[model samples]
Target chain A: MSAPGAVVAAPEGLHDREFGPANAGKVGMWIYLVTDAMTFGGLLIAYASLRRMGNWPDPAEELGITISSVATFILICSSVSMVMAIRGAEMANRKALLGWLGATIAGGVIFLGIQYYEYNHLVHHGLGFTTMEHGNNLFGSTFYAITGFHGLHVLSGVIYLTVIWIKSLNGRYDGDASHVEIVGLFWHFVDLIWILVFTFIYLL
Target chain B: MSEQSHSTKPYLLVWIALAVLTGIEIWAAIAFDGTAKWATLVALAVAKAGAVGWWFMHLKSEYGWLKFVAILPIIAAAYAALLMAEVVAR
Candidate 1:
């Protein structure tokens, strides 16, 4: 509903010329990120309130944060790799772009691997979705729901990154490289969500 | 072009800080009990989130109005979740 990038009226219609479709892409992605932030915020607030209200055991007693931290590190590094990929693209260094994109994909795979390990570890500790040992309690439901949803997001992001990686290899981004920037925006959004999840679900 | 001019070291440092804070959070959760642990964990979380948002995501480097736009919905969603948590708890 709002005009794109014209929050303030500049004298000579500077925004109208400076901010075209490319700028719109950036702005739209930021708007999408705002909604995404809301989603994570809702999950986190639920986690906080539930933790505060109940007499639940601390997270370490049930789930281990150390292992989750490993996964967290993987995701963080992926963000770095993503930035490198964007830089490479902007520089028109196709080889470096693909290399960094490959690194980013590898980071995603490592993160997913760690998540699988954590899921199995929880299951071994009798913390599955349906087991009463963990499920009979409110803590289990809220914990699983929040973490699982975030995991699903990670999975989806991995798929998205994979697509971008493959495209990069095929020289799909040779012309404009703006696609890489857009993907970088999405990748950063995913990374941002994980930061919140690492805090609320694992660390905090 | 602008991104190239900005050093990558800051982002890397923030990432390392996030990893360390996560480790500290886990340690505190295990070491402390009651409200102390809760307080510590929440504080660490806030700090780490700040690092990620500010540096890794480049929110701090962006326009001030953009940062406000980004955070507004998050605050609103937090309130919605809080209300929902209250209802479910009740």
Candidate 2:
């Protein structure tokens, strides 16, 4: 024990003790992701439960699989590009980082565009939020609730990526990868949620 | 950190595997019906999601505690599925 009112220093190895090697930002991101996942989980479970109650239209028949499959493939491609962007950041290759990040952003934009087209097409065909021309009303509500929430995520992700891309353009992340990695976590998470959404909402 | 020196080949491989799995999912959806189709689709979707979490999210290389943190939602999902099963049983 130190003398009374003495300013004692922390032990050698105990100083700056963090949650393992992950920085606070990464840990916080993970925690946020866990919570977000639970939200999606709740929605999905509700979807499944309501689906089990019968009168649910065939997803493929109601929402064409071809377009959604294409969207899924695009999202997958964006995930790959995201990994490459992180790799570039890790290697301190500014050009590769910017290029891959740009590609990832492009993928996200195209996805949103496709989603817009799909929503318009669906609405034009009488798939309103509370009414489906050829199926149960719950289908429209749940489908919009799930995919619309995801679309908002994609939109926010694109904006986030755009900000990061601007910072990269300004040479802000030249030698530091922590920020890029943190944002990558969010972007990848959006993709991950989409995977579940596509399966639950469109395929099954 | 040392493993960071590896090339992007693994990412490419994972992407290819995801595409292939998706193709299989579409095919299964078209060719199968009933429990078989549901089982196949659900299995493939879970596998694909796992691949993304394991590789793209770097969960495979993260700390063990972080991995546990990441899997919290899976536990919740399982519970939800169990409840749904009970509902179905009723």
Candidate 3:
């Protein structure tokens, strides 16, 4: 595979690094994200199979689209904030970096709050983990399994962003923005996964 | 460190496109029915995911092998989706 920037031949006696023109940390994160994607993919496939087996209720009726759509919009906004944070790091603007990173973290916190509220509302309406009043129990099971797993991801992402934000405040990324870029990759992946989850679990 | 210049315009444009596609997705979900609805929603979701991967995740600026690394799971997911189709067709 061709490297991104201009290619230069190594001097006669020197061996080049394994990952040419790519940061090792970035590649490692990509690998981790691939595995995580597969996990979500497996869960979604199973959910679809179970859904196709019949006796499934309409998701729109059970889970209101309005609230979830709001959550989805918030995630998309957070993704933009993440991009800005990376840009800030690249430009070595500490204030911009901290501001955008804080915004991203706030977005995550709000998302989790909305999820908690939604879960509580669902449970109050009789959509328990193992039982749903006047509905198939599997709906509750698969719904929570997929969404709850994603919720955990969001929760972790918030924590991850918080750590990165704290480090940014400490000037850890002033000279090198690679770590911020790596964390940005993880954040964007979470948002990407949510795009799919929203469609499959809430809209479909 | 060498100074580098980056533009936020592209990112902003991508954000606008994503937001518009999401709005269309919601409308399609409410207005469309059956196969049309499912197809539209899936297509919109994929488009949104692609935008995030390409622009936000910087895949467009990545190396060839890295792009390959990113696409590996998509192939796997497609296979899994095919299995779901088979089960659904049964």
Query: Where does model 1 exceed 4 Å of error?
Result: A1-22, A52-55, A174-177, B1-6, B77-90
Question: How many residue pairs clash in each candidate at the backbone level?
Answer: 0, 0, 0
Model 3: CAPRI class: medium
Q: Rank the models by DockQ, top first.
A: 2, 3, 1
Q: 1 or 3, which is superior by lDDT?
A: 3
Which of the two candidates, 1 or 2, achieves a greater lDDT against the reference?
2
**DockQ for every prediction shown:** 0.40, 0.67, 0.67
lDDT of 2 by residue, B28-90 (tens): 988999989889998998999999899889898886577889999999988987998899899
Tens digit of per-residue lDDT, candidate 1, span A1-204: 433433232335344343323355566778887887777676767666766665766566578777777777788788888877877876777887888888887887888788788888777877766553743476767777877777777777778878877877766665445667667777777776776676666655
Q: What is the TM-score of each candidate against the true structure?
A: 0.80, 0.92, 0.92
Write down the TM-score for model 2. 0.92
Candidate 2 chain A TM is 0.90
Model 2, C-alpha of A3: deviation from truth (Å): 37
Of the candidates numbered 2 and 3, which has the greater lDDT value? 3
Candidate 2 segments exceeding 4 Å error: A1-18, B1-5
